[model samples]
Target: MEEGAKHVVTGGGPQSGHCRSVSLICRPLGMKPHVVIEGVEKREDLGSMGNTLLYRMAGSKLYLAPQENYESFKRRVRKMKQYVSDTYGEKCYCIPVGGATGKAVFAFISLFDELLQQGLHDRFDDIVVTVATGGTSLGLAVANYLTGSKLGVHAVTIALRKEEIYENMDKLLKELGIDSVKSADILDIIEGYVGERYGTATEEVLSFVTEVSSSTGILLDPYYTGKGTMGMVGELVNNPSRFKGKRILFIHTGGIFGLFNGEMDRVINKEKAVTNDITPWLDENVSPVSIEQ
Candidate 1:
């Protein structure tokens, strides 16, 4: 929920079987909220999907800000570097990879900016490693082209539906006038560890999240950190020779709240019933019978 983002609700007037409504909370960069209102007559009810008010706000497209993501990424990178150096007594480097969910793209861009400021641009490079996802990958591609970083960006995507990644990346690059983005087979780097489902949490990821929390008391969100960590671990385990003892920093983008919902609580309670140890005492207090030794 960024600033100036308005939550607009549009629905039926407490009646009608076709209660189809759509609400859009759009906050464009610096513009104020522009509301577009529309009304439909009762005679226009075509079907379940068509009888609705289509509200479209004009001038709401310019409020896109990447600064928030950049700031968050900077903070996480600083913390991670500090943690690694303090714990391992060694300096490490972080690379921005994966899709843009959980502000991955913004963080990657912000990391590049910070590196430029710290004069570490020459020491580290940025690579766009696709994870069979779309949003973050496209975001990374767009940001890379926009920032004009000289680091090598290799778009490594999984073999599953990789053509889509290639197509989207090319379209984005072409739109941005960036003609040098390269695509590579991520299998060599990532090592086909993706399981049956597209975005389902892997056992390795679940175990990693559990172990990390148990050891450090830091919870990693299932979607971004868990999956991203699984990918990193797969890379490390299968392609250890590639890293060659080099420090690998996995950016834990914060999204822990995603794991919680009303249904999740119900599921957890169902699995492990909560018990209240209550002892009922009579109004006339029957004193505890002390075992006199």
Candidate 2:
């Protein structure tokens, strides 16, 4: 976050929004971005899709790490940071995966406070969001507790298990100098939403995504918002008595570009549109006039 820093290094999966965001914000700050990607061994293997394409377009230097090797990923990021320091004589600001650091939680806390200020707490009974790294949901829960709001915070887990999500939130809570409160007590982490694993989409969810986009004009990516929305819908259908009259606020975290990461196009359109001829529509009565400036 230091203005004097010349480079920012971060790590995430190929379709990670955090990587794309870091790379994007670095450009205007005159800071070069180095993104370490998981699930691949080289750049060639990291195809130009979704956030990966955005990272390249933002001019970020890319590094590859093994999919499941956490130690190797950390080492790769560290090396990239050190390499930037050695070559450019400047310290590189490193952001963890999903930007899910302790300090990052404060942002969502601030957001919650803003919502309270706008009196959104009175409008909605529950707050629903997709839990990727648990930072946003944790922050919201913390804010809810701190502000004494009764609104329920429900986080639909996309990738990690509920235990893992709790662990991440607990670590963040400790970082904020709070140990008395547990994350599980504050957050309602819902399960059974992650279909076909992370980054993989199901046909049903894809259909829902298209329907939501077409009807509401609010695009939801298959990875994050789409799944979260589907989960929210499922919750309503499965337990109508619980939320019969309660209004729910479903947070649409920005990942519209993620729709391009997979087979969303296939769901939106079964086949490509045929090219049309406009020659017949042209009026013969009006002569084409060319005005040269």
lDDT tens digits by residue: candidate 1, 215-242:
6787764434555555666665665555
Model 1 steric clash pairs = 28-63, 29-63, 29-64, 99-136, 100-136
TM-score of each: 0.45, 0.85
Error of 1 at 53 (Å): 24
Q: Could you give the C-alpha RMSD of every candidate to the true structure, in order shown? A: 17.3, 6.1
Where does candidate 2 clash, by residue pair?
Answer: none
C-alpha lDDT values of all predictions: 0.38, 0.81
Best by lDDT: 2
